[model samples]
Target: MLKNVAVALVDGVTPFEFGIFCEVFGIDRGDQGLPVYDFAVCAAEEGPLTMADVGFTITPPFGLERLEEADLICLPADRRAPVRDDYPEPFLDVLRRAVDRGARVLSVCSGAFVLGAAGLLDGRRCTTHWLHAPALIRRYPAALVDPDVLYVDEGPVITAAGTASGIDACLHVVRQAHGAEVANTIARRMVVPPHRDGGQAQYIQRPLPRTACDTVGEVIGWTARHLDEEITVEQLAERAHMSPRTFARRFLQETGTTPYQWVLRQRVLLAQELLESTDDTVDAIAGRSGFGNAAALRHHFLRTLGTTPNAFRRAFRGPRAVA
Candidate 1:
């Protein structure tokens, strides 16, 4: 029975996040046997609202008062959202009131910050884009912020991390309210996955932040240059002109990771490059990236990236690319 969807817009709103809600709820897809909600875009502040990083202004058809009647209020990511602490009180109040009245409030990316300001996320499990998760956590300590998730559905409050995951979250709402068949049909029309679990880890790739190493500098550079070779701490220590124990300690101090872990992490980055740019077979890429074989490559890749090599390729290079 979920209907009357309204997207609440604020200053510096991101068009992509706003568009996700529109694509999911604003459009009239009833002709295809889909449930079309009563949707409207509302402005939180008066006058034209500027888009984030874009040189255009959009005038919403409705105002903050319109949110009071909504079955679902969608809050999209905004550029000023994370730093700009002073949100319109009227805007935040309506959101709180809506949730109190049993209306669901869904936020995408940094839009969760608005909910946090409204005190809606207090003591509730929520998530935001991984890049912004730390900021969210620091700002809203009362909110249980999980950075490693695609989305979190805390009953009436749903928070989605990043862009595609926002789409996944919306489809999740559709799946819950209507049925799996409806959600699947909508996913087919949008050409996206029908169901990506809320618990799926965000594919976060944190590369080595340093090319300029200290003490163990030469060894670090040498390791990067020779990723395809089976490297050991003893070999690295000898190359660094130190004992194995001393080298290991210095390696941890200088690079913040053990020799073995650094090698494995770098090899995965190399494997990612091979998968994306080159038409290399998984087995071939595995050996070339020093994984010995595809099985080892798959194991390390999944462990670090939370996704399989083939799946990563499909997502990065598109479904047409042969894995």
Candidate 2:
């Protein structure tokens, strides 16, 4: 259904963020049996657009009129997007009209600011890059901003966090349109993980202790390989040659989460993969993912993903797969 796509660019566009839109939607993947979108880059104004932080200019062949035909309109991050209070009214008006007519809109990083300028983010739950979250909130006070998650999807609008999370948001759109099999195939071609768990909290940098310790890292690798087996803080401590309390303390410092929390997240991730890729029953998947039973798995899955395992499978299972 998402056959037509357009990327609307203003001046000072970040090359990487702009390229993210191009990579996901603009590529010709028809040889691989993937959907090839009718994609175009539309300049928001007349004259060549300048690249941010780099001294170069690009002249897009398409103008704002091209956006009128797009099913999905993407806004990539630009340095001026968040800081500038005044945006081109004509550009903003086009975006407003596009959304009013049932077209979906997505923003990457600070690009959410453009949506904010268009009044599209008002009363919507959205997010921007973690570094820019406070600024986005200050500018658009009515927008509910969640800075920790990789992205926020609120029906017609999708906003992604800094940089690479754009890939996740774009892949999510593909998944919704086609199914997990198509999304996974594209992810495989891109050489990035099809799914990522937890939040940007794990990626936040923290100062490490002066003393070097590979014990926690080694235990984590072991636990991943042995996820089907029961693991506990005490057992992990024994393996690391440390007391349970000491192990827990170090784990929180190093991994930004407790041992149990990390293992549980990993199990849920495994279960999601199985649900998408295989025809395994809930009971079998639960056992393989270390939940031991379907009920426990269901509880965790719902708490983490806001959906049941069966419902998730029903939504994501490939069309060609047996029912």
Candidate 3:
């Protein structure tokens, strides 16, 4: 199992992203019967490393050599990461050696850029924060970049989407290394979910309606509340007092996705929440989440999340429903 954990810090590391790994791996919960990893925070540079947009500097207790002993090495978000190409050669070398030696590496948000610079992400599926997705693609043409998901676990290399998604990715590591019960316990202590729904896609910003019209916003709220019912763009357009084509155009402009995609994502999110929080069977969740039947729910769940509903529930709900 994963026991030794180390964080490799470069200059301008964002505090929250760095904190995620520390919270997940560095804490000693031996009294609670949880495994305690040998954790260290190591610096890549010589002097006090500067934090981004902050007034203070940090001097890590360990050096880059500590990473050579780690079972898992974490890279947190650095403010200059998108344009940073000056990572120390020794720092990059240790990363490559870690992978070649069967150790795992995880990058949170813009930290993926550091992995990209080290050529760790070449030909592997990875992700960064959605805003940096385009720049990541431009910088590393060989990487398979998926911008919508919360995280990707490509065997030895794992990448998370943004600040809070770092929490998800770290818990995922814990879940895989330890088990669901241990990960869920850690999540409860941190006041976070062991698993989360949807993706960074929900948080992406879009241009508002040019005419300052809030009709689309109202329709979105209405659709969210009535997700169990059959919803069509025609019905939504009539409610917005606009033609179907006009409504579709305005919806895309205001929401960055089509009406159909928006509803499908919402329904999937609802199914995920119900599966996590309720004792409902798959068929019940399907009816409540607007999937109509278990087969439909399973199909969409796989297409959207790459996992079946029963497996997702088993991950989060302790295998209560066997489908």
Query: Among these predicted structures, which one has the highest lDDT?
Result: 3
> Listing every candidate in turn, what is its Cα RMSD in Å to the true structure after a full C-alpha superposition?
3.8, 10.1, 7.4
Model 1 segments more than 4 A misplaced: 122-125, 141-148, 196-205, 210-226, 229-264
lDDT of 3 by residue, 144-192 (tens): 9999899999999999999999999999999999999999999999999
> Where does candidate 2 stray beyond 4 Å?
205-323
Clash pairs, candidate 1, are none
How would you encode candidate 2's per-residue C-alpha lDDT over 192-231 as one tens digit per residue? 8778765543333323223246988888888888999989
Tens digits of lDDT, candidate 1, 32-136:
989989999999888699998889999998998899999999999988777889998999899989988999999999999999999999999999988888799
Prediction 3 global C-alpha lDDT: 0.90
Residue-pair clash count for candidate 3:
0
- Of the two candidates 1 and 3, the one with more favorable lDDT, higher being better, is 3
Q: Candidate 2 has what TM-score?
A: 0.65
TM-score against native, each model = 0.79, 0.65, 0.68
